[model samples]
Target: MKALVLAAGTGTRLRPVTHTGAKQLVPIANKPVLFYALEAISAAGIANVGIVVEPNADDIKKAVGDGSRFGVDVTYICQEQPLGLAHAVLVSQDFLGSDDFLMYLGDNYVGGGVTSVVEAFRHDRPSARILLTQVPDPTAFGVAELDDTGRVASLEEKPTRPKSDLAVMGVYLFTSEIHEGIREIKPSARGELEITHAIQWLIEQGRDVTATVNTSYWRDTGNVADILEVNRHVLDTTEGPGAAAGEVDPDSTLIGEVHLEEGARIVRSWVEGPVVIGAGTLITDARIGPYTSIAEDCRVSGSAIRSSILLSGSTVDGVSAIADSLIGRHASITTAAAGGDSHRLVLGDHTRIALAG
Candidate 1:
């Protein structure tokens, strides 16, 4: 079977970060969100992959080039515009040909991966198979209603009054019959051919449309909160604290489950783990708290930070405390301003500040 990973959506929700870079490239635990999806696809043993990209997403092309590093031969398909999920499938028909394939949203993070689901799809050979998970807010997702036999009876895309709390997970497996459904369906009220509608079309035609409720972790990393939550989850479960690879002065204290990558230096600081310090980052006379990921080439000195993500080249100096934040690349944060005796901050690159001045 082949794979189609959709990475072309304009992530307006993650704004100003998405304004400059692809949302799929956002790092969770210092690894890009797209890399996790690609790893999941490779683990499912589908090597012939087609990545659907936006027209001008050259960064994505540069980052994922040919997919050889992931052991998958990838073909890049241009979607031209942010049409819809069904439209993505329609455009990828040539790459997919007649092969049964898995369609995965590139910005999604499915903990425990999709290996079992892929195996089940291969064995069952359903016309369409979707993963469902119970979500608190069904209105934000494409929801499904199940019949007495637990089959997918009906589907709706982001309904105001949802019939069920079972939201469709971003991973889907489909046979070639889905192409017919996609062609037969029209755009929704939102003026896009939603995948949910195409699945509903198949269900109307008496095709085998199946769904499996996911009990494991699954998150769509669209907003900052969700990204931080997923990062914390992954770190807690998969990557606990570890030995420091870079230099650590005797004055520094390393607490639980911290992963210090190569070239990371810690001096006169206290670091609490379940935290990952990327390579070449320096933390001196600072307090690094739990659930924080500091990216490469960053410097944190004379500050206290917790539960935050600092991208590469960011500097945090002389701050009292920074928490529950997302700091973008090349950004700088300092406590002193040119005139104010009070707090002064010069923030850049999608920086979010929750503290009151």
Candidate 2:
């Protein structure tokens, strides 16, 4: 089987970070979001992969060059316009000819990867397989309504009044019949070929379309909040029991599940985890709290921060407190004021901000 990853969407929500880079290349826990999907596809035992990209999205190509890093050979399929999922499949016909393949969204995070679901689809050989999970607002997502036997009876894209809470996930497994389904569907009201419509078309044809209700974790990291949330989940789930493998001083204190990457140093500081410090980062005389990830080469001195993401090469100096913030790459945040309180920030790349401390 092969894999098809869609990476062409211009992430308007995550600007101006996406202004300089592809949304798929955004890092969570110091690893690119697109890498997670590629690794998952590779873990599912799919070797040959196709990545659908816009003509201008070269960052994806440069970062994932040849896909050998993820143990997969990738073929770049160019989509001239930002159509839609079904349109992407239609354009990738040459690379995906006559092969069953897994379709993954580049920014979606499915906890525990796609190995089990791929194995299930390979055994059952369904015309199409989709994963669904409950979401609070079904109207914000394409939802699946299942029949008594748990087969996908119908699909609605962002319905005003959803029939069920089962929101469709970004991962899918499909046989060659999906190509015909895509061909039979027309552009939606949004002027794009909707994948839900094509899946509904397959169901109407009496094809074996399956739906699996996933109770585990899945998220589309399209915005800052979701990115931080996914980072917390990844760190908490994977980083077992705190380890001070880095150059932490004896005067420092580490609590909970903290993970200090190589060359990271915590000098005369206190860190309460579920926190991860990336390689070469320095935390001196600072208080690092939970649900925070400091990327590589960052510096946080004489500051207190919680529930924030400090991107690579950033610096935070003498801040009283920072909460629920996203400090971008190479950004510098400092406090010159004599007195200050907790602040919430969403700085972009290379930003410089000075607060009154």
Candidate 3:
């Protein structure tokens, strides 16, 4: 079987960050979220993969290359616009051909990978199979209604009144019969051909459709909170036995599960983990708390940070007590030279602030 990974969507919800970068490229624990999808596809033993991308996304090409690194031979199919899931499949018909394939959203995060689900799809050979997760807000997702026999009975794309809470995940396995369904359904009220509608079309035609509820971790990282949450979960599960490959000064202390990448230096600081410090970052006179990830080439000094992500090249100095925040790349965050009772901040567009001083 082949695979089609959709990476062309414009992440409107993750503004400012998505304005300059692809949402799929957002890092969780210093690893691109798209890489996790590609890794899952490669692990499933599907080597023939087609990635649907924007008209001219060289950044994605540069990051993923030919997919040889991930054990897949990638064919890049350009989607003219950020249409919809069904439209992505329709455009990838040339690359997908007649093969049974998996369609994975490049920005979604599925814990433990999709290997076992792929195996089940291969064995059962359902005409269409969707991965579902019970979400608190079903209105924000394409939801599925399953029968007592576990077959998918109906599907709805972000319905105001959802019949069920089983939100369809970003992954789906489908045979060529889905192509017929995609062609049969009209664009929804949202002006795009949603995959849920196509699957619903198949159900109307009496095709065997099924779903697998992902009891394990699964999140759609379209916003900052979700991204940070996924990052924390990934670090807790994957950081494994800590390896401080980088230099740790005698004055510094590292505790718990901490993985320091090569060239990362810690001086006169204390860092506790489930945390990962990326390559070449320096930590001085800081207290790095658990569930935080500091990306490469960053500097953190005289601060206490917990549960935050500092992107590449960001500097945090003097200002203390940060939590549940995402600092963008090359951004410098510091206090004014003179100490004051009143707080002062130079904020950017879409910047959220809660002063604790």
Candidate 4:
């Protein structure tokens, strides 16, 4: 089996961050979201992968060149526009010719990977299989209705009145027969060729459309809150033995599962983990709280931060407290004057802010 990974979407919701970089490249725990998806594809025993990328996404291309590092041979397919999932599949027909493939979204995080599901798909040989999970807001996703026998009875894309809570997870397994289905379906009301329509087409023709409810953790890291939540989840679950690769001053206090990368220095500060300090980052006289990830080349001094993510080259100095935030790369947060006021900010790349009266 092969894999088709979509990384072409213009992430409008993510705003200024996505404006400059691919949403798939956003880091969760200092790792790009796209890297996690690629890792999962590799773990599924599928080495022939085709990555769908938007035009001018050179950064993504540079980061994931040839996929050799991930033990997969990658063929980059340019998806000219932000059409739709089905459109992506349509354009990738040549790369995916005559082979069953897994379509995985680059920004989606699936805990435990898709090894089990890939094995099941290989054994069962369903015409198409979709991963489904119960979501609180089904209207935001492509939902599925299951028959009594647990087959996919129907599918709808972001319906206003969803029939079921089973939202389609971003992972899909499809045989070549899906090509015909895609050809037959028309664009949805949103002017994009919806994948749900193609799946529904297959169901109408009596194709074996199967659904699996994923009980494992799954999240679409689209916005700031979701990204932070997924980051916290990754930190909480995978924080095993604390290994500090960098220098820690005798005066600093390290607590709980903190991973400090090479060149990261902590001096006279208190760091509470489940936190990861990236390479070349310096923490001095600061209180780094739990569930926080500070990316490479950052500096935090005289500040207290908790439950936040700071991208590479960011600086936090003389801030009283910061929580529940996502600070972009090369950003700076500092105090203008001594004040008791607290600050909350969702800053984008290259931002600079001085908190004061």
Best by TM-score: 4
Report the C-alpha lDDT of model 2 over 63-101, residue by residue, as the tens digit. 999999999999999999988999999999999999999
Per-residue lDDT of candidate 4, residues 1-357 (tens digit): 999999999988787777778999989988999999999999889999999999888999999999999999999999998889999999999999999999999999999799999999999999999999999999999999999999999999999999999999999999999999999999888889998899999999999999899999999998989999999999998754465588899999988889998899999999998899999999999999799999999999999999999989999999988998888889988888757657767788898999872
Sort by TM-score, top down from the best: 4, 2, 1, 3
Arranged by lDDT with the best first, the candidates are 4, 2, 1, 3
Which segments of model 4 are wrong by more than 4 Å?
Answer: 338-340
Q: Tell me the TM-score of model 3.
A: 0.94
C-alpha lDDT of residue 115 in model 3: 92
- Local distance difference test, each candidate: 0.89, 0.91, 0.87, 0.92
What's the number of clashes in each of the models?
Answer: 3, 3, 0, 0
lDDT of 1 by residue, 255-285 (tens): 8888888999999999997889999999999
Residue pair clashes in candidate 2: 337-357, 338-357, 339-357
* Better candidate number, 1 or 4, judged by lDDT: 4
TM-score on alpha carbons, each prediction? 0.94, 0.95, 0.94, 0.98
**Candidates 2 and 4 compared by TM-score, better number:** 4
Among residues 3 or more apart in sequence or in different chains, the pairs in candidate 4 whose N, CA or C atoms overlap within 3 Å are none
